[model samples]
Target: MSIDIALYDGHPAGGRRTGARMLRLSSPGAALDDALARHTDPARHRLGRIDPYGDTLFDERDAGAVFEEATALLARCTTEEQRAAVRELRDLLADCAATPGSRLVFLGD
Candidate 1:
């Protein structure tokens, strides 16, 4: 199954249903999942706490921390595919961090 990390124009939880999708990154296999599973500590790694079986949402306020954790995770990736996926995630988080009113959502299986 694939997992998609999508960026939206505004906070989806606040009844902003019409927000346009700004970007979307998809993980085709277990690459992203396996990398995230390696870091279980929530205090140190926010990205690691994402539930692969459910949905996780992060607003512009959380983009910085999530980007940091994604960057850290990228450094630990051993495979090119894994690195690629995390890199894309990191980039998306970076963009989300810079854009106010934006929201990033991790859509899982």
Candidate 2:
């Protein structure tokens, strides 16, 4: 699987904005849990927003590591069920990024 992170700008409210930095995991379902875990580490600054569309910045190195971990995790899944779950999670991520008012900043891995 492949994964990436993106910052999005949804609104302009003075200097405060609303958006989400998404960790996009494009691998199998089994890897979803690991991917989510890897991308949400507060210490590593890998966290993202909860809003439908919001703006946030992330470190490129950290994002790349998270994706690499996710892809490796997906590759180790032993069942189709796990792979399917990863696919579902990927779809959800894509949907959030594709929201009508969202602006995505894709970070290449």
Per-candidate TM equals 0.83, 0.32
Q: Please tell me which predicted candidate would have the highest TM-score against the true structure.
A: 1
Point to the candidate with the largest lDDT: 1
Distance (Å) between predicted and true CA of 62, model 2?
Answer: 2.9
How many clashing residue pairs are found in candidate 2?
10
lDDT of 1 by residue, 1-109 (tens): 4577888877766565564656555554678777777644666678867878899999888987777777778888888878888888888888888888888888889
- How many clashes in candidate 1? 0
| C-alpha lDDT of all candidate models, in order | 0.77, 0.40
- Least lDDT summed over 10 consecutive residues: which range in candidate 2? 45-54
- Screening candidate 2 with a backbone cut-off below 3 angstroms (N, C-alpha, C), the clashing residue pairs are 18-54, 19-53, 19-54, 19-55, 20-54, 28-86, 29-83, 29-85, 29-86, 30-82
lDDT of 1: 0.77
TM-score of candidate 2 versus the correct structure, residues matched by position: 0.32
Residue 33 Cα positional deviation in candidate 2, in Å, after optimal superposition:
3.9
* Residues 44-107 of candidate 2: C-alpha lDDT, one tens digit per residue: 4233331223334333333343444435445655566655654554444345444544433422
